[model samples]
Target: MTKPTLIFLILFSLNFASISALSQKPKALVLPIRQDVGTNLLVADIYGRTPLKPVGFVVDLTTRHLWVNCETNYKSSTLTQPKCKSAQCQKAGTKYCHTCPIAARPFCHANTCGYYLENPVTHQNTVGELAEDVIAFSSTNGFNPGPLVQIRDFLFTCSPSALVELKLPKGVQGVAGLAHAPIAVQNVLASKLGLKPIFTMCIPSGNSNGVIFFGSDGPYSLLPGLDFSKTLKYTPLTISPFDEYYINVKGIKINQKPVPGLNISLLSVKDTGSGGGTTINTLLPYTILEGSIFKAITSFFAQQLSKVPTVKPIAPFGLCYESKYFSSTLLGPGVPSIDLELEGKDAVWSIFGLNSMVEAHPGVLCLAFVNGGNEYRAKVNIGVYQIKDVPLKFDLSKSVLGFGGPLSGARTHCENFNFTTVA
Candidate 1:
């Protein structure tokens, strides 16, 4: 017999796929995220109906599958994986296991259907069985009493093990997948909530809390009047082979002069598996530049510090100088500006320097661009830190991505949701 969880998954998917309710005026929800331990992750409550203590999940755009910490940690006791020989198991038989390259999954020794996920950057693995349950985001920035949005019969995995070296008690437990795939929590919730297939992320800066807004340009957004989406720079949004977002880079300019090093082939298959691999990820802790581009920027930094005494390099960071001796503004107000090639001149998304400098220690600021390895799959990322105080709008209806410039001074984070302010 089919497991009840698998049955619910099949029924729930079938019900929503052909629903008669047409896409109405888009509804929007803005949920604030947590910046735990330098990683910009969305920490939200799971399973609103259950009385279980809340656990936090990382809302990473590169994660392709929804999963929880452990089976015992799972709030819903009824959550179960389809047994071997079941249709869900049969489906798993066709898909490749990245970890066990020799065989496909449901290579079950135990009767449970299972899979393992491996993250390339952190080299961590989350192993578990597929299951179903409900997921909910708390209303007020994960601090208040009630759930803002709750969806029942949600399909996800229950993982009991993870090889996490950086795990902390006030840190990530599970990953909330947001890749543009069937299993992505963002896509699933967008469909169920009657919202647009779009969202926006803003970090503002190093001090403030960030928020993710769903349906940025639809009827739900305050674009024309109160919102800053209208004023953001624009570019033609492209998709990777693996269903992640990509943007075109026409060229990079250093102090208004074109830097020829950025013009190179950066083609790489991103989001190749169930884990993080997107080229430009908001949640990625560091910004990565293609090798040649990284060299160009560091060399520019070197010339600026030629007069200063020898500065020791920080591990992982190729360039670092004591900020007390050197001006924190060595890269200056406008050093490296990336010119993104959009269809028209008006749509270009120019880059800035405030996003590139990293403060590693007391009175120390380093150019934070990591050298993306020589592999064809390596990607250049505009991480959450690089886009500080800027708003990135993913407008599905227009198939365009908007990137706003930094706000004047340190802008305070926006609070409260206004459902009545329909556009």
Candidate 2:
């Protein structure tokens, strides 16, 4: 054989080996029987908590199934009849072979019926028919067999012990015990999407009287980009330096009264040394107007003790305000309002300002305003300024401080004085 031909053959063999290895690697397994069991049956007792009330009992007739015997108590009974036998053998006086009625059977007192006879050759056929007949009879007699509600399965419950048993279809191997079955099923369903489990709870079934508990799972991280669907309703206003950006947002409704004092502090994702961001307590005395949007701009001043040829790299941060309207009403003619509040920390301002400076070199300013917290107006004018440029001691009357809004608007005024210094 030629040298080149031999080399090609060796390479081909190596490629085939690699492909075989790749095919042998295990993939995520998704089990077929993944459904909310909580909704299927009423969970009277959880594993760790108090014992559950008995829902029902199980009757197993499987031959040689000793496991069933260990879990249940068995009882048996017999029937007997008595005959009037006096002088019948002597003179036939009041002698009779008394007939006993069916109701007189002793077995009836023990809650049992006639014993079932089994044969070796007919074992499979007989047991199969017996199971069907038992189920049918139980159903007709108002006894819940608790058989498999779905295919290839069977269920039995021990109400007294709060025990439940599940029988998988034949040939399906290695079924987990009842305690861990739900978790196993959950892992299978989540494998395909690479999702993590979160809170799990039982949701009440609409049709059945029972509750179905499904594990609610999601990705650990929020999607990187801003969620636009959550943003479209509220307008993103401009931010300024030194002026703490205060946002008061409310919802609007037709022919409803205006709501007031629905205010929230804008927060920044970045971390500042002082726990970065404004909180509701710090912004006290400022009332959030109902149905109106409040945006307060503040001034920003940068002071450098030493002037250098190179520009100092400063971290810029600003606030991102989000409002969720819980309820709203119509105020006056065509006026609307809502109830809302803020969430998160105080250092958010610094982080937001730093990021803002890094991304866009917008001038820093501080703004304030006064308006009713309950009304939403058509339009308003907000003030903005830089802290360094403003006079160290300026008269309130001379400065452009308070905000202007329509009379029909809520949130008429704002008050909160706190600041943080970061080097």
Candidate 3:
């Protein structure tokens, strides 16, 4: 072949290979589960402040099926709150007795015990059989049962490695990072033991905004390490994919002027107490507006900022706003009040006005206003401020099946996993 033709053919082949690699990248599948509504029964049974064996089961409320795997099926027992026959019971002339004297077994008295009968086809000794039963029960109930995402298959090949990458939705502002240690561990346990996935948010130190990542298990690195105690604390809001969690801050103003527009920017400032300072430290650019509350910004900021070192210290820092608009002088000089409005996802917006005068040194102030005989306010402090309040919208147009599937081997220790971004 001619040299020129050969060179052109080689370049075309390389381009084809690059395109193929990009097309085969793994994508995230986030399934939201309502921990409050659907998992009520499970929570009552598991976290009822009573110590019990960690028995896992799937309840498909949609199908009205209750699948359980206990060491013994005592549902037919005539005794209410049945207990093992003790020596005391024997001395009392009864082989066994109910713990409560007034306790009664209505099902036993009614003789309608068909539901409590054991299945003769398979003894409940095997884990696989128990899982099947649980799945069946879940299907019988109205609670929607998600498709069977094989634990081994899903985690094994969900990504090229065990580590997964997450990005904040556009319009949300905050630093990005790993979820807190306890939250991360809880999610991992839920996926491994409860066979469920969870979502969580984290913040970086000194920053007021953050982000959320949805998936089955928490990142391994997010678990308790040598410095677990130092990690930020996270509050689990809702347990479903449909519900969004947020934080709200009140009483903020811009140079004594109420922030006017629906979109507001959170900027990180250095030396907040100074009368007029311009040296600004910009962290993560912008975050989506989930709600019109400062607490929501705080929640998201704490989660995502935990990952990036440059933005880590900002998590714990307080937010400050200029009480007067274009007043140049701090609020202590009696400047006019300014109001700011921030918008998150779902068209939700929060308003905070700077009403209080700033102290000589850096500190926080609240912008106050009265409505219907009730006063409302937003928080504005003098410190570092990060941009927050945008829509919670993400781009999923370009996505591929995430790692961990049939092609991948069984789940391995997280130490064996590694993640690298494809630029």
Candidate 4:
């Protein structure tokens, strides 16, 4: 989406309450965010009393935990143990799953009080002391960059264990939680800088090229230039079953026919791990839908593939056939948009056939969804694969998410679209 004609103004010297409109700036420190092997990460160097090395910090919206690499290279003179006296210490006492007890041991032991989180997948431990550090977003552009933002005394766990990733190129040094929790990186920054508690990001497909902005007000309410308010859709954030950002999914329909039993309710999503709001995660490689929804979607696929000669089935991915007919199957294939009914009949999020398929091998693509087995409550995981190239903005202040695309034919610099208040 292109920026509108209105202007965004930033008053650096003004108090948080004062920077209401005009984009509330000293201009948002726009930074580049890239996808590294399914993980959305940014470069965030951690520096203590003595400077430590700066490295890539993965941004995870699903969980609220701040962690830094506990590599041996981190030997700063100022690393201090977290004091049990403060509430911050209680939260960072240990890895989230460890369930560190509330007693004295929870916050401190052997004069070392910080945190320890074991990698659930790797079973390795990341141990560190709760300490303060600096968080900065490395600039992507060669020029027209804003001043470096280094938030000092930033509280986080400094674990020494290497992040265990099944895939390599091992670019992540730590994780900065952006899940809107009390201790999240974004929340801490908003509170400290007195800026709006909101951020917007566009994850570009393929290239590690993407951008992020921080603000609370809507783009339309702020500046006309590069405003999303035009096509931006709104839905109330779902709060129960999990505190993560979720919109009420009223129904799922294909060819305008609503599928029964596919919904977002406390009972339906209680076990979905559906990062569908929690328990369900968006970063997963494939989308997992409730069995009923899965059946509905696949039924449509069967009709479309009838005359087309497709390749054989692939593992994990639900469908695969000869790719020779791929291009034909996608074009005018009578495949209708999969509409996600949200809030009211007027609100619909459409997922076309191209959006639901993933290329698996040479000249072949497959359906990237599965029946989220009985283990999960009825939930839907909006995997990254389905959202690539989509421009979305999460208004932390409003708890509303807006996404735009038919996959713009021309590249839209939505992330680079920032405004400065008139001098």
By summed lDDT, the worst window of 10 consecutive residues in model 1 runs over 138-147
Off by over 4 Å in 3: 1-151, 155-189, 194-228, 231-241, 248-285, 288-423
Quality of model 1 by C-alpha lDDT: 0.52
Candidate 1 lDDT by residue in tens digits, 1-423: 113223323333343333233233325555544455544544443433243234566667666667666533445554455665666545434242224334523322345656655443464775566555555543222122122444565666665444323542244567766666665665666666766677777653543335567643632122123356556666666666566776655445554555555434442323433322225675566677656667876676566556655467775678876666644342233334544444445665555556666667876766667776554244467666666566677765566677776543223232222322211
lDDT of each: 0.52, 0.19, 0.21, 0.52
Per-residue CA lDDT of model 3 for 1-423, tens digit only, reads: 223223323433333334323332112222111111221211111100011112222211111112232223212111222122433222212332223224532222221112211211121221111111111001001111111221221110000110111221121111111122211222333343443333322222111112222342333121122111122222112111211122222323443434333223322122223211111111112221213334434333323334322222222223333323223332123333233222222211222221222222343332221111111111222111121111111111111111111100122211111111111
Order candidates by lDDT, high to low.
Answer: 1, 4, 3, 2
Highest TM-score against the true fold, candidate = 4
TM-score of candidate 4 on Cα atoms, chains taken together:
0.73
Models ranked on TM-score:
4, 1, 3, 2
RMSD values, in order shown? 9.1, 30.6, 22.6, 7.7
lDDT minimum window of 10 residues, candidate 3: 153-162
Q: Which lDDT tens digits does candidate 2 get at residues 275-333?
A: 22221111111222222333222111111101212232222222211111111222111
